[model samples]
Target: MSQIRKKWLETVLKYKFNHDKPGSPTIWSPDLEKISRERIKEIQSEKLSVAFDYLYEESQYYQEKFKQAKLKPQDIQSVEDLHKVPVTTKQEWLVNQTDNPPWGNFSPLSHKRWTTDGWMMFTTSGTTTVLPRVFRHTQHDLKMWAWLGARALWAMGVRPGDVVINCADYGPAVAFWCLHYAMSLVGCPVIPCGGMNVQRRAFFINTYKPTVLLCTPSYALYLGRTMHDLEYPTENSSIRIIITAGEPGPGIPSTKNRIEGLWGAKLHDDFGCTEVAMTPLGYTCEDEVNSVENPVNVHLMEDAYIPEVLNPDTLEPVREGERGILVVSNLFSEAQPILRYMMGDWTSITREPCACGRTHARALGGLHGRPDDMIKIQGLAFFPSTIEDSVRKDPELGDEFRVELSKVGDMDRVKIIVEPKSAIPKSSYIDPREKIQEKLKGLLGVDVQVELVPYGTLPRTQFKSKRVFDMREQCY
Candidate 1:
């Protein structure tokens, strides 16, 4: 290890082995986290040197890719040169899986290699536009994931003594298993409530009274309502911190406010995907909630993952403050490492200092949306998040809704089918729908058709919410 890495690891081991108490969850490695940009690059270069060499040697996918790109492992030594290696997309990854069964060639170490080493297998939920992507992580990668996960949880106010209830479905997926293990590493007791129904989860929350909750934003609202409907007092629940991942709800101002209002708990967003996750465990601190303006930012753990925002069409870097698709490269992951992977989530990034005193890069609008969710109204393209930001802002609408895109005769059109909140029962949601359509028109630069449906008519999910219904490609 480089001297910087050696010292950094020593500091972390001191905290873990000696049981050193951290002043805050965000203070994992203060010395290195806030280190100068130049210093971080130097450390990143050293780690990348080893990572690239490993990729070149272990996997035929990367070996052939490097040859096709006419590049050597040494040529790309730092994050700056990552562009030289083409971005890996979900399409390419799925093709690799088809070409090679179970684990793709990108898997540096397969299950056979992990037999003696001990590894965990996780696959993408495949809830969105793409097929599921599988990954094999060794014990070392899991430890690293847990460390970053702790950083995210800490920023979200999860302390060592806090008891966390993670309600996500645990599987070969990302959220529950990784986050449960991460909270465990943080010295917090994690109640794995994966297989429980909403009523059972509510019962456990009132009985056990965990201080923190790990779930999707939609589930938080669902569970809280269920608790109330079941005659269980939601206010009496012990949860104070609610962390959401897997979807783009908590980041939406209305959704965030609603989750906070219902649970009486501060909501934090933990963002990452199956490909390259928890490297920085996207986190939100007090600033995300308390800022006078623009506090809704997700801090990327930059110390471990190099993030870039590039135009999806051109695949070139976007201006510093401009919004674009997020592409990430893992600095530490060795099992199934992805380099310059087009993460498909759209957002703008800023290296500016956070109000919460974190210096890591932050995504301003959180996850905007995915490629499959993109829609064109008039001449410009917009994501589901654009509509989500507009729809959730209306207090008359409930947290649930569906956005459908189709060809209205010869013109491309967008229709927002929103569900009314229980607060305004039996009344037509026309006023709110009109209000939302007006706001969306002004914000999205196109007229949007709005229809308000009765509450609970749309599909609701215990996991991630599937809000976009696109029928534009169908031929009648």
Candidate 2:
């Protein structure tokens, strides 16, 4: 190991070996479920108020915002009073950047103070039109991220020593690098093979014979398809478990089942973002499905931050089970304290006790796609995730596909390009094109035309896959 890596492993081992002192719950705890809802709310409210004070003093954006709202920190007396404070929105961040280019007006500290030793920076993929945001982490952030990852791995039933093949990308991406670091913490030997070089990936799998697989859903499907073409028994391979993240598929039943059946591994899902430091929303084995029973308590890093969710339309608090935009308030981050910062993803909060028995608020369905991932098709809105779900259900269709919109003559044409699952007798198989089209019409209430192509036609993605290729001029 490199000197830095050696030091990191030493730190990890110290933390893991010393974790039995009893400050936090064990990997599984039925008593955590018994904690009353009111107590959780009380803790949440206290953290919010503390976060508000931190932001008001440190961030210029929140300072001005509070001034304009004509509210004082004392006015936010209780957690219920949080409703009186205005809701943060994605537009605020966009507008702030427009008002102040590069680092926005909300930036809390000077650029120099943000420097750290043995730290890394990860950039977000600008999903819509906004420029990508950069997230910085110190050695401390790396440690915390590793801790949560260790928890996630343990929940997946990963023992102390195992060989894990990390299929996530490298360089500036957090998911790929952070996960590898975490696996190292748990004493799992990690192999980083990112990108979509199918033959090479297959070669590595066959040669290395790893016990655990880490990859995104899209790439997982691609790898599975490559193995299938070679007549390899991928499902019966040596890999025992697949820990998935970046996009929600390993957790989604149909996609999960297909991957498991193809790779012969159990799938576990995780959720996180570049903006939230290194902590993640991970799955533990105590639940039936990785439900909203448990979540990483980054808030306990009250020394570190606070998190929230709000309704985008009404700027009101969404009740548990109601979808809303995710907002965060970083309490302890003095270098760049984000107070009431709005993150554009959509998901619901669940306050109920989970089968696993943790009282921490759970994002019930992971991130239910982003708010901006919606597209209008034949006057109805459709999310690509929904389209993907429909397409993947049919085992016959290859996972690689794209949605393209174009103008032909007087009307708008919606075209879905998909590769077939296998090269075997196309005549004997029902065309997945017609099948997907029918489902889109039935589920999305919009008529869409589907096009079929040979396997390996669509370009593979390493990180976030582009599901749509809009070719229409007038639509733009």
Q: Cα deviation of 399 in candidate 1 (Å)? A: 1.6
* Model 1: lowest-lDDT 10 consecutive positions: 11-20
- Give me candidate 1's TM-score against the actual structure: 0.90
Per-residue accuracy of model 2 over 1-476 as CA lDDT, tens digit each? 23423332343333232232222344422222235767545644555565566556556787789889997755664567766666555677678867877767665544554563436666677777657766555665566566556655665667655898887767676776777877777778887786647777777888888888887877787777777677766978778887777776644556766777788777676666555434454353435343333222111222233456677776667776777877665433333445555665676766655555455666655564666777765667767777777777877887777998888775778888887777557788776667788888888786788889888788887667888877777665
* Per-model TM-score on C-alpha atoms: 0.90, 0.82
lDDT by candidate, in order shown: 0.75, 0.63
Best by TM-score: 1
Estimate, for each residue in 1-476, the C-alpha lDDT of model 1 and write its tens digit.
34433443443343331123344445666655566778767766666655676677667899899999998857876767778887888888889898898777886775566897766777777865366767777777777767767666667777877998889878787766767877877789988887889999999988888899888888888889888888877766788888888877556877777787888878878788778764435778766765645338888877577788999899999998898889988776657566788887888989887767777788996775677767766688877776776666677777777887888688877888988777775755346766788888888888789998778788768887877777878924
